[model samples]
Target: MSVQVKDLKVYYRTLRGDVRALDGASFTIADGEIMGLAGESGCGKSTLGRSLIAIDGRMRYVGGSVSLDGAALPLDDQAAMARHRFTAVSLVPQYAMSAMNPTRKIGKLVTDLLRSRGIAPDTVLGEFRRRLELVGLSTDVLARYPIELSGGMKQRVVMVISTLLDPSLLVADEITSALDVSTQKAVAEAVVEFRDRGFVASTIVITHDLSILVQMADSIMIMYAGKPVERASTDAVVSSSRHPYTRLLLSSLPEVGVRYEEHRLSGIAGRPPSLLNPPPGCRFRDRCPLAFAKCAEEPPFVEVAPGHSAACWKA
Candidate 1:
């Protein structure tokens, strides 16, 4: 496994109480696998990604362990995680356009970043230029400031920079959410291309777009209010999901050929439960159409079919 997270719990401290952002999220991403994490807003997908790289001040690592390539990650210790940040694990955050420094030229910024990480600038020069070319950007872009590039260009630049050290795992959090359809496709393809070329071993593509996930991910994991509701291969999750939440989510998606006028799609009826003080048992119980008295108890994420797992009483 390239990445293994077991019962990882990360909470945000507030005057109200501890918001359990990531409560017992456990999964594994095999070598070269692209895992897609899908959920509605505030479902803790971003929290899970951020915890792997850097936990913000308000966030606290409550429990569980994370391992990359069989080595434990010191996620709780911000200073200690510095040793693994770029070299072992990297992130292409939600706003890739704003990730670059406004003042410095792209090339200079890369050099400064490398120096800060104790890596000599000259060491990766050839690889850097090669990566730029692979991403369809000219070497001259090195001289341009962040302001000179378009949103798509900036996103691509961030992708190249994030994978510069060839990390074992890459966390891409809604990296394509802000782009147009064509640009989004291009960027999404570039992510798979990076893995194909061994620039990164495995990747976690976190987004609420199931259609995009269908195009890029090998496996899909559905989360509902700080817990995994279902996990399976992309094909299985889309075509034969067992979990009610997964079924509702998949049904809500409008495919390219499917038109609303002919086949009007219905969205999930109720809003996602608030994570601040979420309900007892399954968090999705209130919204699940198939929820029963058994739902009063949390369902285990068990395999219903080969490579298909769901956490629902109905399943």
Candidate 2:
């Protein structure tokens, strides 16, 4: 396995109480797999991605184990994780446009980041420029300030910088959310190119957009209320999702050939349950149309078919 997360639990500490962001997530990404994590907003998708790479303040590590390339990650220790941050694990966080330092030139910023990893800037300058070109960015971008670049340019720059050391696992959190439709396709393709080129051994693309996942992801995993509800190949999930939540989510999407004027588009009703002091059973019970008495108890996330898994009693 390229990445393995076993019963990982991460929560956020607030004055109200701990928000059970990641109750107990267990999954594995095979070598070179590009996995897409999709869900409604605040479904702990980003939390799961960030937990594997870094645990920020306000985020408490309740319990869990994250392993990359057979070595265990010190997810609870912030400072100790520095040894793995860029070289072994890296992140392209949400809002890539705003992630750059507005005060410094892009080149200087990259140099500073490389130096932080104990690397001399001159040593990787050649490869750095090449990567920028590979992403359709000009070498002149290195000389400009972040404010001077467009949003897509900034995103590409961040993508290059984040994976400069060729990390073993890449956590891309909503990397394509802020781009325009055209730029979105370009950026999304860039991600696939990154994977195909072996910039990272495997990648986890976290987004709420299922269409994007269908285009690029090898497999898709759906998350709800801080837990993984269903996982299967992209085609399998899109065509025949077994879990009620997954089926409802897929139904809500607008089909390509459908015209809204003639055929109506449906949406999933009801808001997601709050993670703070969430109900004991399935978090999606209240909203799941197929929910029954069996749903009163938590369903184990188990495999129901070859390479397919779901956490609903019906599945």
Candidate 3:
């Protein structure tokens, strides 16, 4: 496996109390796999992605283990993780447009980042420019400030820089969230192309859009209220989802040629439970139509079929 997470729990330290953002998430991504993580807002998809690369001040690593390429990730210690970031595990964070420093020219920023990592900037300059060209950007981009570039350009630049070291695992959080439909397609394709070309060993793409996953992800995992509800191949999850939450989520998507006036689109009802003091057992039970007495007890994320798993008694 390229990435392994076992019973991972991450909490946010709020004035009210610790927000249980990630509650015992366990999964594995094999070598060369592009796994998509889809969930609604506050479902902990981004928290999971951030945990794999680096944990910030407000986020506390309550428990769990994250392993990349057979080595444990020092997520709780930023200084120790510095040795692994950009080389062993990398992140193309959600806000890539503003990720770069506006004051510094792109080339200088790249050099400083490489230098901070104890890598000689001169050693990788050639490859860097080559990748810029590959992503449809000119070498002159290095001389321009972040303000000089377009949103898509900055996003692609960040992608190149993040994978410059050919990290074994890459966590991409909402890379396409800010782009237009056309730009979104292009950027999404670029991500998969990067994987196909082996710029990274495996990738975990965190986003709420399932349409994007259909194009880029090999497998899809659905999360609800800080827990994984279902996981399966892209085709299986989209076409034959087993979990009630997954079914409701997919049903909410508006199909082409289906006007809401004629065939009304349905949305899942009820709000996601609060993570600060979440209810016992399944967090999604209140919103799940098929929820039964069995749902009062947490369902195990066991495989119901080959390569497919769901945490639902019905499944």
Candidate 2 has an lDDT of 0.92
The deviation in Å at residue 165 for candidate 3 is: 0.6
lDDT of 3 by residue, 136-202 (tens): 9999999999999999999999999999999999999999999999999988888888898899999
Candidate 3 Cα errors over 4 Å, as ranges: none
Writing each residue's lDDT as its tens digit, candidate 1 over 4-101 gives 99999999999999998888899999999999999988888989999999998999999999999999999889899999999999999998989999
Predicted candidate 2 versus true structure: per-residue lDDT over 1-31, tens digit per residue: 9899899999999999999989999999987
Clashing pairs in 2: none
- Residue 78, candidate 2: Cα error in Å is 0.6
Candidate 2 residue runs with Cα over 4 Å from true position: none
Better of 2 and 3 by lDDT: 3
Worst 10 residues of 1 by lDDT: 250-259
What is the Cα-based TM-score of model 3? 0.98
